[model samples]
Target: MLDQSLLSQSRAGLSEIEAEYIASSLLRVCPPVSPQHTNLEVTKLLNEHPELISIAVVEDNKPMGLITRNVFMEGMAKPYHHDLFDRKSCIAFMDKEPLVVDQNMSIQTLSFKVLGSGRKTLNDGFIITDENGDYLGLGNGEDLVRVVSFLQAEKNRLVTESINYASVIQKSFLRSSRESMAAVLQDYFMHWEPRDKVGGDYYFCKKFDDGFFLALIDCTGHGVPGAFMTLIMASFLDHILLEDNRHDPAGALAIMNKKVKTALGQINDSAAEGFDADRFSTKQNGQSDDGMDTAFCWVNTQNSTLTYAGAKTALFYIGDASSDVQLLDPDRKGVGYVDTPMDYQWTNQQLALSKGMCIYLTTDGLIDQIGGLKKIAFGKKRFSGLLQEHYLKPMPEQESIIMQTYYDYQGKQKRRDDVCLMGFRF
Candidate 1:
């Protein structure tokens, strides 16, 4: 009897049988092609191979570039787009280094390639290639998602075997506030992210005995390290509330400003020379890069008072009427970028937040998300309009409205930067 046990492989206790099935089914064969074909011919080929995506633009049997469906469509729609019908070759509109994969390349490598091409349209897809630059049919985006989904199975096997335990490692770094005083928070929800896993944007909600604190912090960069800094800052905020006692919102921010500048070590000496780059590693290694921007606030909901202190973070508040939406602008200097730290003057704004009023905090992400292939952003003005339109909806439906509007604006393009949106209803 053929050994049935040989057919199964375990990862984190989940079986690879599903993964193997997917890998095999996805690698299913189809009619493949080469480049150097004309646009007219390629369009015809797409009709036949309707599943086709990228095609290498080969000249003299050597791959010159890639012609993706988007590039072709974009070119065809251009105001100068007239020669497409009688085009000599697809090379004219092809992407020189369009994201590609080699046949022998590991599946991990392939998975990363698809992810790096940024996000794609529902029907939009990617192409596979051989070492010799020959086309190997199309690869569906859903297929890559399936591979990651199955990796969880393999990861589980490792966990069960005690070889490795990585479950929740992806989310392990996210933490909650420690000090619980008289924190009174009625309700709140938010999504803070960069265009990537690591976001330079952050969110914090600390509940006090009588009031609560919140912030929408945007750091220096756009992705990767920027996101890492957000995590570090989040941890820093947690520690500040637990240890340091900065009771008022402005006081807390002033303390935070001093701590941040000390931590980032962006200060100068008597000679006007900055701190040694090498010695700055004591607190922050500066190895992965250091420094960030910020905005801090403390709202005494019980007392109906809002205290604001900003460093490069724009604030928006929407009340029952359109007139209630307000923007709290920051000074020219960000937290780490300034020479002399300014004294924190608490600007207390009195407001009577009725049941229908809302306060929104966001980084540039929400408004800056790519609107279309033409490259428009969702934008501040329109985003405010969206808030007004959804203000009438129940809190439960409001989240859906915001997300739907984001996707509708972003469509299928890759997110250019992190998107942060926090809305609080009274």
Candidate 2:
């Protein structure tokens, strides 16, 4: 039989860190018995310690096997069983192959091992050993489960806190941009809704001496990955606008395309000569193909004209003289992919601005949202109809009506993506 003092020594030696819990922390004081011990001797030990579900069999301080309480008692209770095996060695009834784990193993790793070792190990418990394979004690599967659950909840709490902080930063950036627009425009309204706490869709506005530069960008993906892309895109746009291309919408777009390709390392050998191929390659041994679709407008208040340019995006305008809503379609290609040419040039569509003419720009998220009785996209037709119907209303009222209509149509369907819409009346 095992010494009771050894169990006390093992428990006194353990010290846990706040960082993580290891296998040793799950150890319980279950004394081991030699395999040469008789069944009658094992039975007496069990009777003395009713709390132990199983006992380890060790020889020379190294674990040999295990004998569970239920299995041993069932065999000993059979007719003529006591006479045949009461004096025999406990090895006759001990499990030869038992689940044994290192005391230093992480709780996460121990959980996996216990699950894979089958139900018997979980029910009867398992042996815990030191580094040199010496028997330490036994571990309960129930304790392991509780620790795993607590760790998972703590991890989720930290992740949620970080994401919420990111949302605050993103909103602050957007609010600053909106203030810049408000300084120049006579009347304007913006409806920005992220499918998550933070998203990839963003709008930018910068006041210029001529009038102002405005853009609505839909970056690749949504949520955290997409939100990261928006920051990258914003940095590039700020750098590009600092140049002389503030009044040139098409020229700004061309420079933006090249910059995005370079920033994301999406450039091919033919597009970027002397580029570091090995240095720019992603972890997957390939370049990131991520890019954004954008609608850019350079409004010249002095010239009474608006120069519009887009890459896989469009602009809508309703003139004060007409009830019809006009659409200025964009180029058929997107910006900053391996497929788009490095020298690709977008054309500018200049339109004469009029008093009380309302111009609108939006990301695809608003149109692609799936809902309504037929479970169809909100679509351009429905969007144009809403604009035409409510173009004469005040900017704030128009925003409210448009958002309410969108929500009513959406109903119980899940939001598909980040949505951003901007409108201004000149």
CA lDDT scores, all candidates in order: 0.54, 0.78
Put down candidate 1 lDDT per residue, 149-188, tens digits, no spaces. 3343334333233212111211333334312211344454
Off by over 4 Å in 2: 1-161, 270-285
In terms of lDDT, model 2 sits at 0.78
Predicted model with the maximum lDDT = 2
Cα deviation of 335, candidate 1, in Å = 1.4
Q: Measured by TM-score, how close is model 2 to the native structure?
A: 0.61
